[model samples]
Target: MANSSTNSTPGSSAREDAIRFYQIAAQRQPTPAETAAYKFIDPLAGFANCELKIFEKNSDLGGTWFENRYPGCACDIPIHNYQFTWAPYPHFPSFYTGAQDIYKYLKEVAEQHNLRKYIRLSHKIIGAKWIEERQKWQVQIVQTDGRELVVSDGETKDGEQGEPFIEECDIFINSSGAYNNWRWPTIPNREAYRGNMMHSASWPDVDYVTGRTVTLIGNGSSGIQILPAILDQADKIYVMLRSKTWVTPALANRFAGENGANKIYTDDEKENWSKDPEGYYAYRKEIENELNARFRLYLKDSQAQQMGKEATKKQMTARLSAKPELVNDLIPDFPVGCRRPTPGSGFLEALCSPKVEIIWGEIDTFNETGLKTASGKQVDSDTIICATGFNMGFVPRFSIVGLNGCDLREVWTQELPTAYLSVTVDKMPNYFVMMGPQSPLGHGSITGSIEMLTKYIRKLVSKLQTEAYASLVPREAATKAWLAHALKWMEKTVWVENCASSFKNGSSGRTVVSLHPGSRLHFFDLLEQPRYEDYEWTSLSSDPLSMFAWLADGFTAAESSAAADLSYYLVDAPHLKQRSRCAEEPTRATATGN
Candidate 1:
């Protein structure tokens, strides 16, 4: 991290800085990205005198973790790499932490940080419009705390509906995750064939798969995780895949104890960590370093990429040797990291089992009994689970009217959703997005990207409050130019490779939107500071001299007391001290030698 300086504000009789900021919280176990937003905004509410309101559509935080509780649901990445660097959970059940464990961690984090008080659960911001006249955003929300009335069939009963309400805010932060919207497969007669249909996003607690014929659609993360888990329970399991995905055995299964499965921490190791927190941190650093070292795997045609691809293929082939017919259909032709690699520890083994069926074809339609493949084969399934992935439109489900009443969706439709550094936009003033289009999440730990973005947001918010700016939007040229630069960089990356991945843009699925072309470290270096000249700013006052009136007599709040640290100007002058010592060190050494 780079060195930074801070000065205490001179005590002012003027009212405290009161910026009304609203954050759309993701209703899942807080990912590293959401945690970054919380860390940033929490301090702003404290010393910056900003009012914070975190709107959660669900009953709690832990966006994905809280919602998706399917059997064998666990994180793909190592737990250490998945978490915030500042906040480490040394003691977890396994290396691949389960959904409940992650959710518990996030809940603990929120409570420990005192962020729960700022959260308004069961409230969703439905729509938002930028008010050009007032220079603030008018947000429309629907609160469903006590209003939702469900029938015996789990349908919304005919009762009082949740009404939409509006609130205005100076700054709006969209921390709602990229994959928040769960989508069903575009198969015909989905409504008609009503045999226990459920998406992985909203998996019920009941075990419908056990002793039943279960059909799973789409071979994404959810599908991969659910396969091995229900193999023993389900009498028959049919996994339908439209395309092949590379299942690498790089990550270990916590339970399997095979194919690079995570090593269990022995009692001695735990005792050692308990004795020394620094040692535990050092151990985590070792894991993090190993994760970062694999960045070269993303580089197309690199040696690391080739090695990874081969290793994955070998492991997958070995595991599926029992079923020679399915091996060819299971292994992908593309490189391992072309799409996100799913760990295939027990997954490959499960495919070889007689109880499982790997259907490698497009679906024709769904009947009242089961589904029919395009090859004229009917697969009988009592329960159809659509692990078909989320609706990654990249745009908000609710409408967002920007300048001149132009919808944000319309602008993105004109051209793919592009933003300045994937955060600030051209027309969207005083609006910021977390994990926006072209966010740096393709490689390495996503937490690093989140932390970098949070720091940038902190500076942007500080500038807005201190400079008395009515609003700030990136220059159209700057945003466009950055987008161009991003496209150029993406040309060399594997993300643009012809593969079906969530990183692709919207329904088109050709343009990559969710990932950065560069490494996480590169993004961190780039976003260390903002180029103020790149933004178009508006002042509250028309007079040029009065533009900085918010500065208030050129004195900070801490400067009111005479006994305050007057010589604090040199607090960040460590370099000067180092230089002085260096200058005298040679002289002293020469005299001592004589």
Candidate 2:
């Protein structure tokens, strides 16, 4: 639980309006015990007791806090709504916290839950392989200090150089997040440019705009935030748009009310919000309804029958005409949602600056001094920033060989990545993906999704330990059926039809990463518990103690000719290998490199 001061009012000199907006939006009060029954489940308590490990590549927690460190990087979701219901933070200040606050909150959560001990900071996971003999996963991780950490050891530390390492675990969880792995377009001579260049994910620490000509590529969220700030420092700022971006106006607020609504809420206001059951409920429902209604209107009016491309064009034209010179280049040919909508506080105003220029053209190539456009025009610049997003479509960059040498990535490559309830993989046993493909909640805060997933994972681990199960893997048929339903559900949603956003497929031209059309509550309810029927459990009961001992010792009936001839042994065999000595010999041969 968070401290009481978080809900208190701000000081007089502070911004009261922003603080109040966040308070209403966050719905910071706790739910009734009945509503939060799952939080008290002993399964999570037990799971938390066990040693956990998280593999992270960077210093920051997620993409939101990692890449977009621009001057005005702030969350759009109200601060209260963004928090995890189970682990509430009473100290959180506003509804829409800036990047620094978000980072602080993540650190605070880690501290509160004692999760820092579990995280393997600056370690990159290269590969994971399932050892059928041990019925455990061998995770291969490379640390920043160039040391390999294997799970077999209770703790990972600096070991002798060139020594092999592996970590053995009953389960695996991937929370690599959506962005931070930068992806640059395949433009000719893009690397040959003799100018300062940086990706939005890896922003340079030094001053980038000291009254020099600057070119910013890509008009996504980061671009919107950067353009306005850079205009104040740069002599000439050129915003290069490879594709049209949807610009949505953002609502900015300031504090003007009495009381320190600007500094922090008073003790009374905090208590009122937390303890008043009816008032909290009403306020929460109101915010949820408002957000839902806005989403509905956006989706409804986006249809061809309502406001088609012509209407979008007209709206964009009017917006661009505010700065006539930008009209020729800033307007896009695609639909508004075809890409991610960029919300801006001063994007339109920034473009109206005489020093700013918008270039709407394709880059032919980058020469030593400047970029050459498709129209044979050359734009000179002293510095170039590649704001083009990440490679989300290509996930699990490492190969995962599960039971029977089945490659998990290979299976997903043949079809869109799908899972049983978006957590368990079909052939991959005991492997849990935190936010797998098509499971991202684009309309809500990802922190909410993470909390929900943590609950689900806790339950799964409990089932495994309680059942004395050797391994648990998703039933192939169940996963196939679930994926079919998921694809069908996505077809009815706006993400598939609206935009050419990276959340969808770039090659096949389909939306496969984000969630299907549904409310956040709907997805939350579905993921609340694990559907047991969708999985196949393998246990010790399947084989007696003596038989299990023999299996554990790497012995098979084929090794003993007398036992091999017994039909009773073959009857209990899990696979066909017991009947064929020659077929089984190859497994041993491959294991020993014979």
Candidate 3:
């Protein structure tokens, strides 16, 4: 049962990873339990395989990076860690890069992988239902030119939207990330303001901010970044914050700029990385290691947490010394990492500027001209920007009906979002999710986890394709066990503290839903291989022998072809010599955090 695929390179790309996983799997035999299940041997027939397709609501791909085009809309994560390992771009403009720069890089990766042709742009998934008879998903799609806007009032207008259509697939993967569903502020009478009002998610042109008095609300990640980006363009600005948040310093490497300073790497420095590949790898790993060691700061009342809080306060106070009143007004008493802190490079400097006005209070109401505060003060402005973020719950905005017509939106939203390892649903067969509930994407560099999860998903799909499985679904008991483990582990993390973070369910939610309750590396370890025993499966074939269908005709597709690498295993025979398991994956020492 050797794999027909000749792809030997692992961790290079998704397709290659799948091939490697299957190749490794082919050399092994099934466990005793996998061979003993009764319902698994029940009467079932074969299923059909369909062609692959991808759809994007936008005219282009880039998902959130394309959607959030606001001023100062740059990623807080360092550019080194922000990019994919498979597709490396040596020439990064700055440490904290802009959104468009990322968008372009992502597009380049897509085109390099020749994925653009498979993706159907300007098309969105509005509804999905499980068709049991067909053993597939019937997905409803809406094709658009990508100009429609869902305003604050939850209405779509002033843009063209095409009629709905249907498409079927053997498996469905939801790639719509957590932050894509941007929401407006829930303040009463939000529609009263007739000025150039915009949400941070739906940013207009920079020209819209020029020569105007701008007011920014909600000092989240976007708010902190937008203040500095608009300071030069706007004549004056008034910022309002409903609660306090911590702003972190830079991930200062030796070859970089000051904290909050976006360092544009010199051409010479960028070229040197290209020439010295090892040096660049070390540099990237250094930053990753530094971040990796910082997990101890999240522990409640730990020495690192205490020290980090004091250090962050000192940095913020010193930076905002020009306007000392802000120190007491903005600094939160909660733990430093209670919410995910952004690397707010220019935020403190912008607030210290004379042209800016900081107001810490709830918005009473919005007038035709400007906004009014609950403190009996009025701030008149030409433009009002609601840097209000999105609902971070992993629930889909569209309709999704699973087995027994179980509604995904209702199950996730009405109750709690219960996902098996944040990849598959409890009852939804053949459906997979990326960046779903209990995901570990909140830590360190997301690209690393993304790559690991890519391999994870691809491996599962490979099993389904090669094995005789019609559908796979997580058992409800397994989901409960996973969720219980998550909650118990989360008790010691900073994310469960009192804070109004997007990580939680809502303003009053204490349960952290946005991320996994473990170190980023630990999460990667869990997803290293798919756990077949954790899920329930229905084979597409009736005969028990069909499970070994991969043993097709006593010969592989590779053996039939000329110019095949028959001696490939022996070609790397020297490297294939025996190695200890501990040598392959070393055990962690319980000595220190750093």
Query: By TM-score, who's the top model here?
Result: 1
Worst 10 residues of 1 by lDDT: 1-10
Candidate order by decreasing lDDT: 1, 3, 2
Residue 364's C-alpha lDDT in candidate 2? 92
RMSD per candidate (Å) reads: 5.2, 19.5, 10.3
Judged by whole-model lDDT over C-alpha atoms, candidate 1 comes out at: 0.72
How far is 163's C-alpha from truth in model 1 (Å)?
A: 2.3
Give lDDT tens digits, candidate 2, residues 1-594: 001111222221211111000000000011111111233222444342244555554443443564457665666655555665555554445444567776676666656755455555555566788887777788876555432222111133433224335777777665555554556766799878998887776666787777789988877777777787688888998888765565643211122112111134457655776777566556545555555444432243445414544554564556566676665566655445455555554676688888987776788999888798898988899988777777665346667889889887787778677767767887887787755765754655566666676677667665555334567888989887877787777665556654457667433365565563456666678878678878888763444342222123233324445645544544555655665876656787688989
Off by over 4 Å in 2: 1-49, 59-68, 87-95, 146-164, 249-286, 292-321, 324-336, 505-508, 511-513, 544-594
User: What is the Cα root-mean-square deviation between model 2 and the actual structure?
Assistant: 19.5
Error of 1 at 150 (Å): 12
**lDDT (tens digit, per residue) of candidate 3 on 109-149:** 66675655556766666788888877788888766666533
lDDT of 1 by residue, 1-594 (tens): 111111213332254433423333332225643564466556643324466667776667777777788887888887766776766777676667789988898888787777677677767666788998888888877776543211111122232147878878877777777655777788898877868888888787787988999998878888888888888889999989788888877552322344666555567766777788898888777777777677888878989888888887787788779987777887777667777777744787887899987787899999888889999999888899888877665666667787888788678767778878988887888777877887875675577677777778778876766666778999999988888888888777677787878776323244676777587777778888799999989876666766545655455645666787867767476588887887877877687996
Question: Candidate 3: misplaced stretches above 4 Å?
Answer: 2-50, 146-160, 252-256, 543-594
> Which of the two candidates, 1 or 2, achieves a greater lDDT against the reference?
1
TM-score of each: 0.88, 0.72, 0.85
Worst window of 10 by summed lDDT in candidate 3:
24-33
